[model samples]
Target: MGELQVEKHVKYILAVEKRKDDFESVVMEHLRLNGAYWGLTTLDILGKLDAVDQDEVISWVMQCQHEDDIAGLQNEDGSFSGDMWGEVDTRFSYIAICSLALMRQLDKIDVGNAVKYIVSCKNVDGGFGCTPGAESHAGQIFCCVGALAITGSLHHVDKDLLGWWLCERQVKSGGLNGRPEKLPDVCYSWWVLSSLILIDRVHWIDKEKLAKFILDCQDKERGGISDRPDDAVDVFHTYFGVAGLSLLEYPGLKPIDPAYALPVSVVSKVILGK
Candidate 1:
């Protein structure tokens, strides 16, 4: 029954922008990643991009060809590592593929093998995991499905099965949890909803109820969203909350491409060079 505090949310996001020379707060560093995804995507989606701090937006046209070490992250089996330290996960696959795709250099990596690696992480329960033989989870499903969608390889997913798995994440309160028997969290609205949308199964969930749930988690007066109502608000959950509302077709918000996790218009420019 609550409404999205659009102006308040925008102010909250802008209020948290990391000042120059700030390197101590881990929380600030997080929302600032990916050229301040929280600020850019939220501002862009909310039609408030004019309020963005241009210098805070780092549009890196990173070199990822063999010259830049994207290939080095790939293992023989095709999964990618988070970095030189070699920690592997479907999360890394999404990060690597999404990064390269935005750079217009997806071909620099082995697409066929990358798809194979992501597919291997799929479980019979119809959801994806962090690694092969790992437990299925909503966040992992988002990463794997997003990677597959970006690469034009979604056929590798079992849509019907995965859709059912994702559907079960919604609790009686209308909020979604990451996995079975877990408490619902605002973040899953982005994870589970985006994955369902990518597979053409978004309608299976209760849109109105989920939207109400997300709205209920917002700090309406101060402008930020939390994982649950009555909890502390942070930019991370605010990012997911606003992005989820966009996916739900909330009025006055722009559409975001579920796969790229960017405003749809921005994705066209980033990937298609439009």
Candidate 2:
């Protein structure tokens, strides 16, 4: 029942960014672009985005793209690879597009083809997968749906059917899982909840119970959230936990756009060209 330690969470995120050579950073180096989005979005939601140097962060983001590792990761079909190994996934497409869009550099990619590829991953169940014919999963669904939303291609989604599927992820625990028959995790709070809101089906699930689940996972002592209560905490879950609360209209927190996963203010400036 304790309050969210906004300052402590902010410090944790900042510390993660500052320790460039740490074990966690080393492991996250492969997807630093996505990590940046998560951290930056969390900061903005907490109303502390100005704490970092905008120009410096944007420069690093651009460099992360142009570097030989991530460059040319895009396939002919518009799918993106996570690294030089060239494994394509809808998740990469979402991360890359989101990062560039936030930096006001969407012109750098073939957005039309990107949308086309995501559409290719659509399933008859009104859900999307990592690639064509892959079974629909909540995590992949979020990435695909989010990318489509950012690009104004939401018309591609079948709101009712998809909403039904996403809403079904909620279990008796009031927590949501990535797919049926799986244990609900706190991270899905963002994935499932955001997808429902985007499709206008949020009312299908029990928001009150879900909020309580996320709150229970918070480490009131250490100031971060975990995937489940009484478990170890990390920055990733911490961001999702807070973002989920933001979606739930928790007081004292900035509103987060379900699709872009960024603060309403930052999304407006970056995507709306305001």
Clash count list over all predictions: 0, 0
lDDT of 1: 0.87
Model 1 bad stretches (over 4 Å): 18-31, 59-68
lDDT of 2 at 153: 89
List model 1 lDDT by residue over 177-227, tens digit each: 999999999999999999999999998999999999999999978999999
Please provide TM-scores, in order, for all candidate models, with all chains considered together.
0.91, 0.85
Candidate 1: Cα lDDT at 250: 96
lDDT (10s digit) by residue, model 2, range 176-248: 9998799888999999999999888999999989988998888776577889989988778988999999999
Q: Model 1 Cα displacement at 34 (Å)?
A: 5.3
Instruction: Please give the distance, in angstroms, between residue 159's alpha carbon in candidate 2 and its true position after superposition.
Output: 1.2
